[model samples]
Target: MKNSKRWGRRVLSALAAAAVLAAVPVGAAGNGKSKGKPPASSHRYIEVQLLGINDFHGQLNVTRKVGGREVGRADYLAAYLKQREAENKNTLLVHAGDAVGASPPVSALLQDEPTIEVLNKLGFDVGTLGNHEFDEGVAEMLRLIHGGYHPATGDFAGADFPYVSANVVDAQTGKPILPPYVIKRVNGMPIGLIGVTLTETPTIVTPSGVAGVKFIDEATAINKAVRELKKKGVQTIVVLAHNPGVSNPDGTNASGEIVDIAKNVDDEVDVIFAGHNHAYLNAVVDGKLLVQSYSYGTAFSDVDLKIDPRTKDVVAKKAEIVTTYHDGITPDPEIRALVEKYEAKVAPLVNQVVGTAAETITDEQNESGESALGNLIADAQRAAMKTDFAFMNPGGIRADIEQGEVTWGELYNVQPFNNQLVKMTLTGAQIRQLLNQQWQPTQTRMLQISGLRYTWSASRPVGEKVIDIQLPDGTPLKPDAEYTVTVNSFLADGGDGFTVLTHGTNREVGPVDLDALVTYIRQLSQPFSAQIEGRITKLQ
Candidate 1:
């Protein structure tokens, strides 16, 4: 009897799903319409605009000079978006992902609450999840979406918009952490939106940030969600993925992993919005539109989709990459006020003098492969942990400590993730293996180091790159010798494609990396300054 009941339920479900699919035209641009001519006035088309941004990273008060124009700050973005949307009545403002994470002192210090409030006021309809969304862990991410107080940082109102991720799921329950998709009605047309993040999210972020959640393949997740949305009579689909883009100038023929995913996804998906590489791209792939504005609130992607009223399917689409310049654009008073509230709150902690820099430490690395800032950080880590040696990832150092007094906020911006120092033991050979790992997967940045020096031939074959290794005193490195190595928690967890670090044993974790820098800087007898010392020599 139970078996019979289950079978009956399946049959009923199939019938209902079929009815839903029949109600909506769920295929190509003109799915249910004749291809002969334009529809009549009664079946007129409505142009719906999609205003998208990605990797905002909570730059409420930061600015970047792009193309010789100073731009950015959440206020400028709000003002420009408001002006643009004013011209188009039917518009939806959305973010691809990383709206907040690895932010500056102004936003990061407040746990990004102010950014959320500003986004809410900005009228963000919906957004996706980037790997950074998981930086503070899933619980914090959930808190950011729903109204609640942080366990450590008091209560506050939360986001007005929902953050969806079709790919992020619970391992045990096999259920998504958030809603897989959201349907928004624009100009009387229901647009289905599915959100996805890079499947490699775990590899990039701190391991604890995404525990118990599984990030699945982007294309598979999108195809599945597209099918479900189609069955619900929602045909116009867009995917917000937190993946890097293979950029091409203008909106024609840009190719990358996103393009590959677009090609594999079902035809029902009309657009792809992406983040993670902080790039500006305008491309059409798989007969669909894909875009990503550069990060830090400096740019936005404006896409227009013409929907046929008769079929509710997207018939024509065009996209442009818009740079957000502060010139001539007045800051939205509400957003500026919102940013100032947080800015005022963080002043005391951020404005404290940390240390001094006699020489300007730039992020630009020398030919031998070391940046002054990177060397200083690596030195600080080694000093703080009392390790035999320490190495820093090139990506971790976000800003340069100028030749002046480095404030606490400046130090925070340099190592904003608040990662702790991890000391572990590795065989000399394993250390070499770690060096070789840098060249893998196409990113060949040598780590910023302290207490050791090595030369690797870039022209040499992959595995045998590191030619000579020695300590600072000229003692030769022995493959059989075990040595104490220090790295940040991100590296110890094998982040940034350095899986070899996971093998290290006898782990001893210490203070946060930024804190280590703070203490190390204060202890410097002179203003803390470092120069690239040819620690990592790459063959020309």
Candidate 2:
């Protein structure tokens, strides 16, 4: 429901660690005690501190709640990283992808250049590309990486750290656009880091943008890369992966795809850092370390790995996922200054007033079958297209709109990705199949519909579970008739398992998704209310 999933155990363990550490006296250290001189052994222990964050979406400035509490800004995140680096010499800061696009106005206005600038300044060692990174098209993505200038400052600066995607390849040439992996020498050890984005990139990203690119099997790519790295004599192998791992509600590892990848991957890989589902995870899977920090910089993960100098393999490791709270920590001066400068440059555009909301619209009710805000957004898209119905994935909605005067900034916050709307015609049978698929037990089949109503029994087998279906006008859906439906490009290209929508006829592009919503809201001066009633009913 929150458009992100994390392992519940990770969050609970983090909180538990925090609680236990808080109770101890300040000077008390855990079992990590070491003598002044090196111990007499053939192998040596080199402490490697890996700090990881993912799915930033280019938020540059701190956000204040209605009550003035601050959360996740680039500057605040930099401070957190700087503190950790100061404590360890063998430190590497990495991102697991989706760092650009879906950005706030400050970074969005500059086409996500500001966010990259901040990342470079913050000393990010490497990053994997997320599906959204291709939203601007592959050419634009390359331009941004090579010589793109920041929209806010007009300064031309390239990527400070290499961005890798071993799985994404050119369809015609079969060559990777960027290098698949890079070897970094950290404190006299040659560490091979392989970065891989999700194979679902084509389905989730705009088709035209990724027209000539093919995302290969992730496991295949990683295996191939690891073999090469090992041949090159690289001892320690770290994988920065942009794929989703199974997680429970409170942030613990759940048995899913990631577990299989960890257990079956080539033994050359020692650690796996993951993202895409935006869930927090810090668990050992099949004897390999797996971690995914929560999205939007809400938390950062610190993995302390002790590697044997002779074998270059991990001997002992500990991981802690820490939340970024402004209460006790002070912002790093350099990062704070950078954020302040960017905020000033984009102030006017970000502060503009947009519209009003009659009630609070939130993404918090993600676990439930229906969401008031998600329904309102789907309805708006349907109305804009003037079609038989509309459907929106809950993952597309990013932020919550409070009950009060809303600004264009607030609207952008809700649907920040700037995704376009596409209308297509589908047969009634195809629609039923699409509706039925939403009940899949795998959790990836859920759909957010706009102009339709249906009752379903999740307890039944997925495809046979739809009990009733009707059009927005309350007409019983005719299985043979063709109907025009409105949906975002993400789903039309088969994102979130809506392959049925891709089998439609007379497809046409409409307005951008967020633009359509903005237009609908601008036309209404009075506050509008929305509710999730029978749009999707769960029956026993």
Candidate 3:
């Protein structure tokens, strides 16, 4: 095994620099030209292109629609990356995280090894973790990155590239779990890449996923890494952060956690690639360029930097968010074959027809914060657990059930976390408090419900938003009355900030959530459907 300390010790060999020019998308900031004025004729700058993508989520065989154009799929993403790499040999391919976990069947079924293999084939230089990377726990994550044995897929070669995360550390040791940063040389100048994931990881991931690790402040970890990199004479620094942020289509009005991180980090940090929210962001704050591509391989961030070779610092930087539209380029045949191989391997189980939807049941929430898909899944869990009510976090419902036959593969995509069902007891008042938590200061997460209804007031205070709660039979929920409640393992453990769930008693673990959903669909009459039944009401 390679020495863990040596992970970031090697300095990459130098590469020749070249000019990069690409057309900018509409509503973005960069003009497809280098940003700064030309350097003195005697001072030639080293141009390095950083190609980055975030929140991939292992959509190996999935295609998504962006602005009416069919995009995504691993092969197409590979083609786009390869084309961009050819434009500048000094380019470094990097990802901000969520490369795996919550993945579709093609990759998830094989334990996400295919995603790692694809990254290896594409030659990813450096990467960082997103919350989803901890979905199955640290051991599984390391197995996917550094290679190890898995019962389902046998031995694996793991990731070819190094993964750096300064913030995630050992719970007992209080030391970084991986190299905090990696250094690469371009034109004989050292460039540092530091990594950090959101500190809210513990709350978002299942307990076991982060069993022995603790996440610290993103900026603190970053600034400390910066000091270390500076001591080593590295001036040009980039951060690969699995944090959230968003910006207007024109790259204006940027705000999110990453924006706050950018403002606080050392000014020597030249660029940050953000992720987790899976949104488009291309803006400059605190003189540092920050960018994020919309997730699922549909887009990528192309950041160009002009590094002053003598001073070893980035003097000029600009970025453009590029959509992977399938209008012109052909998908890479080799990657397509790789995807097909995995697909065929899992076909027998995933391709089985589970049920049919009479019409599209989407996770799109209405003004009342209710969705048909969420209702369907919540009803399934409630029914499976024989509970009085069930609540599903909106984020857990990943995709829509379109009009037509629904396959196990499609269902797997909907709830990929494999969280088991938890049946517990909660008082009616406790349920009300749970509903109120949907409107927290940091986030507004509406919980999808089954077998009950509630009205919440927007004008009311955060903890008092829920005005009333009642059973489906029109019986008002009694504050002192106890009732059974059902939620997936994630929520029962207080994931997504639903801390009220943790107070529940008499918890009984049930089948995997996907199994409950599958059984519910199977036992239903053909062409069965679910809809918003006024389960949630919003008052202005």
**Residue runs of model 3 more than 4 Å from their true location after superposition:** 1-43
CA lDDT of each prediction against the hidden true structure: 0.79, 0.73, 0.84
Rank order by TM-score, top first? 3, 1, 2
> What's the distance in Å from true for residue 522, model 3?
1.6
TM-score of each: 0.90, 0.86, 0.93
lDDT of 3 at 188: 86
Q: lDDT by residue for model 1 over 146-257, one digit each (tens)?
A: 8787765699777999888899999899889999999999978999989999887876787778888998888999999999999888878888988777454535456567
Candidate 3, residues 1-540, lDDT tens digits: the string is: 000000000010000000011233322221222223324555588888899999888999998765445768899888878877776778999999989888899999899999999999999999999888887889989999899999998999999999999999999999999999999987788999999999878877778889999999999999999999999999999999998887765567889999999999999999999988777678888888888877888777888888888798988888877766666777889899999999999999999999998889888788999989999999999999999999998888777788899999999988887888999999988998898888877778888999898888888887998998888888899999999999988899888788999999999999999999999999999897888878999887
Best by TM-score: 3
Pick the lDDT winner.
Answer: 3
List all candidate RMSDs to the true structure: 11.3, 4.7, 6.9
**Candidate 2 residue-wise lDDT, 206-286, digit = tens:** 567677788888888888899989899986888888887744423344555666777777876878888777665667776
Query: What TM-score does model 1 achieve against the real structure?
Result: 0.90
